[model samples]
Target: MIIEKGYDLRESLGVLWKNKNAAAIATGLVATLFSTMGPGLIVMNAAKSGGLTDAQAISWLLGIYLIGGLSTMFMSLRYRIPVVTAFSIPGAVMLAKILPNFAFSEAIGAYIVVAVVTLVLTLTGVMKKLVERIPVPVMLGMVGGVLLSFATSMFTAAINMPQIYGVMIAAFFLSMAFKGFSKKVPPIVVAIIIGIAALGFFNLITPIPLSLEIAKPVLALPTFSLRAILDISIPLFFLVIGVQNIQAVGVLMAAGYKVPINAMYVVPAIGTFINSLFGAHPAVTAGPSTAICASPAAGEKKEFRFIAAFSEGVFWVTFALLAKIIVDSVKMVPKEFTAVLAGLAMFEVFRSAFEGAFAGKFRMGALVAFFIAVTNLSILNIGAPLWAIFLGLLTSFIVERADFRADKIENSEAIEAAK
Candidate 1:
């Protein structure tokens, strides 16, 4: 399919309207909720623990969601790919842990350093070259390992809340079975409806009082500290690039898109720099949320699937604008419900990654990576995903080298005999 050159709002809206279906809307809503509500709450809580005032916390949240929305929108339109951007969850967790020790300005300074480093890596093409060198099996294995826990949690969560989750799971499979009968309704939509109905029937969902409040953005001038740079900036940079970006590229590739690595890094790096000025964490390509937008259920046609991501961006902006109301509403839903939904949504992605990782000659290497990733092991403060890929590649080289040499020698012997 030919991609349009420039971003046009009218064209985007038209695609959204034309291709809009239950699946697309469901994907957008789920992705938006997952990206903003939970992560936003975590960041706010963390900031509060770190001695940030209510106003400061609100500024961080608003900057994150607002910039994330705008960046995702721009990238999706520019590339005609479902590229969703959001704050790094791991980064936020790390910030929460370390922010209590440093001044907020110091944290902001560290964020700036991370953004500058990311931008430099992208512009120098170092990141792109590194990504290219990573074998596909290792990449997919790492992604599959990362997602394994989430996918398996569907069953454990269902067992804990048998009635609601059981119905939801049944509805998911039933919807999948019945999808041929209805083009407009997908399994995810059906499952959402079933889950909601189950929640209401069981009186599990509470009604949240709605209030509208605009978030005020606050700018905190950064103060650089060697300590903050070492403790926060460097790790944050590696987490975003190594773990988040790797999964982002893995998901998109699993969904059959060849996204430019430089474009991937450049857009979010700039967004992170801008948002950091307002006291938000660095934005990176969202992994789990982007999977929803890239899923086949998001749209029937691959060419127009980006509309789902665009719709998600719209929801993100709307949520940021109505932060108070959206957060309250999201809190009304049970956590288990959201987990099941996320797991179900990601099941296909996990399946694809698993298949891709182990499909060919590097099966053992892929398996090694997959298990290591599933362990979620971290060494030297770096995320397990990166190590999984590195170790997996090393194993593949060691195991497959002999076979390669034997094949070369056999080919040489055959050539000599023919001569």
Candidate 2:
């Protein structure tokens, strides 16, 4: 099914209105919750390490969320699919490491360079076609590998803080035990409520005064540096497209969505340009968030899944506009709670990832990719996801020659038949 059709303001708004439901909204809320949790913290830590002032850090958050939120909403509505996007977490980690070595101005220049490169690929449609050719099994393996950490972190947090996670986990399972209850309440929402009640009952809550702090975003200027280009731009570019973008693409395709691949690349390239101006990393299609929106849990009607993405965009935009208030509010919830929610939310996607990875062909290659991703191996600051795809493809090429030959023969026959 294609998400493409003529844009109609009245019809578009009506579609969203008609699809509004508890499951889709809860999916979006969980996705947004994950974003504001660890991902948000990492942004702050990266800014501190980069020596950015409070105002600059706020601007970074603003740029990250606003561009990300707007892009997500636009793509979901425009394409009529759950086209979710977010800042690259690996990009943030890379920047944290590289920032101290080079000036932030130089880093901004690198961001511009990478965004341009992404845009160039988008305009030519090279990346989308190339990405489409990748075998689904290997790609799924890489996706599973990339996401394994997020899933495992929940259990880790639960081990450390059983008081909170135990209650939440019990609630989640209880919700799932009753199909009728889960359909109405959403298992995730139930978990959140129980988690909160547990926190309050144990007197672990630290209440803060409700107040809105204006996040005044400041403009930043860029200056080119050859060293920064070599050190940052090349790797950053790969992370944004090769790693971050790949995960989103893989997850959606695995879920049987006819992704608007070209548009996905193009929109994020534009978002990268916008995000770079205010010190945030590039916005690429998001894996976890997209998975949440695209999964069967979003709603019974697959067509309405895009509403989850749109809702996520709404949350992200609100978070961006009210950065200080939302950030503070997010902080009120325990990190363990967020971690468990994220981890639990991803179980369906993770299961699908593994199923696709090992079911039919290229199992060896896919397994290798999954291993690399789960290990978090990095080479020259390049994250494991890229390496996983590379090594996985290589292993398939060398070890599974017959599979490729059969695929090639099938394609050739189809082409000849068409002719």
lDDT of each: 0.73, 0.75
Please count the clashing residue pairs in each candidate, in the order shown: 0, 0
For 1-419, candidate 1 gives per-residue lDDT tens digits of: 12224558667666667766776767777677556534665575467559887667777877788888888888777777888988777567556556777889988998899888888878876775555443556656766776676567678989888889988988888776765532345566677778888899989898878767887778889999887776667657766786677678778877777565677787788888888877888999988778878988787877777877877888888877666554455467786776677667655556667776777656788888889877865566555665776788789889876534553454345334422
- lDDT digits (tens) for residues 3-71 of candidate 2: 234356467779999769988888888788766655766676568668887677788899989899888
- Alpha carbon deviation, residue 324, candidate 2 (Å): 1.6
Which candidate number has the best lDDT?
Answer: 2
Q: Model 1 scores what on Cα lDDT?
A: 0.73
CA displacement after TM-score superposition, residue 224 of candidate 2 (Å)? 7.0
